[model samples]
Target: MELQHREIPVEFLQRLPDGIKIVKRHGKEFMVVEQVLGPGGENLMSDAVHIHGEPSIRLGVRINGQEGLIFVDAFWGGHAKLYSFVPDLAGAAAEVDAFVPETRASLMVNRACDVDGCDCTRSIVLTLPDGKSRVYVCARFGCPGHAIEIADLPPTVSQTISSINFFGVGGSEDDWLDQF
Candidate 1:
């Protein structure tokens, strides 16, 4: 499916919360996650692993009873992930239990994914520097479902920002986007 790139809401840019920033890539502006914390306030940004030329958000995850490390893209609405160990996702709706790699604090929240055809009821929550703002990602592997909630911004603005997918749906790395 073709991914639609939505313009970043001006209100959000004016009141951009901490831990998230706007970046210029190929002369185009994009929102990126600069930092995120686990439930125990452990920094989940890994400088050692970079995705899309930026530090990745690292997390420990257990999928289908197999535990491993996952480095995720920091770009907002991006779903690129690198797994330390291959997960045997028997089906598309497989769920994951995500936690802090250092403190093991649970990052899973009881939130249902809004993506159609996906029945995942759990989400991985990443707290932004502002504390009140959060980024929620669907726990189901291969599901590009995520949402952003900013404390000061309107819910509609946050929702609109959450819908920006640069690499297209399913996080397909199409080189065509690089031309922009």
Candidate 2:
């Protein structure tokens, strides 16, 4: 979909932390923290903060800098939390994960923030049971469009391709010919 990006104020950028990037998509903006890790090469979250043992699942929240909304997906109870950023105020912060070569390497990859306003680069495509497909981005947290289906996309947008695709549908003429 076409979106008119607003000029992000300098003050707004100043309020955010380093390594975070601003991305505008479908008419909204989001603040994305790309690389987060757990002890077992999984995403880390508030409730799931532990330095030992690999849990079966990981969790995180997608932050919307504009509205101060934090969107967590089904895994994290599927809710949005309100948070305001104060440049002068210091609070609890995210610490880097245990830095082993393997853990550190895993942290380098983007987890695809699928939130509406986030601009995370990593995405994993999933094919639904009904033969439809979607893309999940922003591994650091959960938000709307974090797990969006291809069929739900606007008409102007024909296909959604990401760095990873669960469905092995090739980019062949037969695979995408009907989309046009």
Candidate 3:
């Protein structure tokens, strides 16, 4: 399926685990977001997100070995239970349970430019721990995933990835992409 690039707000990304990228935003400039991959790793958008005055959008990322059972089942539609798989550490921080609706908001909240002015093309990618990336095109008019339905989305996002404010992470875009 052709993924349509959708715009999202900044606040939505804040709900994630951390280390997610705001990429860029400018006074309501649109941040691109998309459902790009199946599992493991996926980018939030299909292409770059451009706002009129900002440089970031809201999004959380998660991947293999991190997401707990609730997120795993709701997002991937799989029967695997992370909590059950590793019962000893059931209450681990990484194993924190996320409300399905709030989880979907992280992705669907930004359906268009906050001002209804401009929504740019974006790309999404899923990066596995192995250091490989899988790209997906952001949806145009993204599906407003219902709170009840969000329980079925793969929790491939985390706050740790977005909260990464590398002091000397270099000010160049290429510098960041290189790390991914």
List pairs with backbone clashes in candidate 1: none
TM-score of 3: 0.18
Q: Highest lDDT: which candidate?
A: 1
Candidate 1 Cα errors over 4 Å, as ranges? 1-4, 174-180
> Candidate 2: what lDDT?
0.31
Q: How far is candidate 1 from the true structure (C-alpha RMSD, Å)?
A: 2.1
Task: List candidate 2 stretches off by more than 4 Å.
Answer: 1-119, 142-147, 152-180
TM-score of 1: 0.92
Could you give the candidate ranking by TM-score, starting with the highest?
Answer: 1, 2, 3
Ten residues in sequence with the least summed lDDT for candidate 2: 69-78
Per-candidate TM vs. native? 0.92, 0.23, 0.18
lDDT of 3 by residue, 2-61 (tens): 112233323345442122223432232222222332232433321243222222222343
For residues 1-180, write the lDDT of model 1, one tens digit per residue: 444455888899999999999998766788999999987779999999998888999999999889999999898877778999999988656788999998889999999897888888999999998789999999988888899999988899988888777766545655533543
lDDT of 2 by residue, 1-180 (tens): 211223434543554333234544345453333333333534433344221111112332222322121222212111232232322222222211212222332222345454445565654332233234322434333223343333444422322222212112223322222322
Work out how many backbone clashes candidate 1 has.
0
* Each prediction's number of clashing residue pairs: 0, 7, 67
Among residues 3 or more apart in sequence or in different chains, the pairs in candidate 2 whose N, CA or C atoms overlap within 3 Å are 111-139, 112-122, 112-137, 112-138, 113-137, 113-138, 114-137
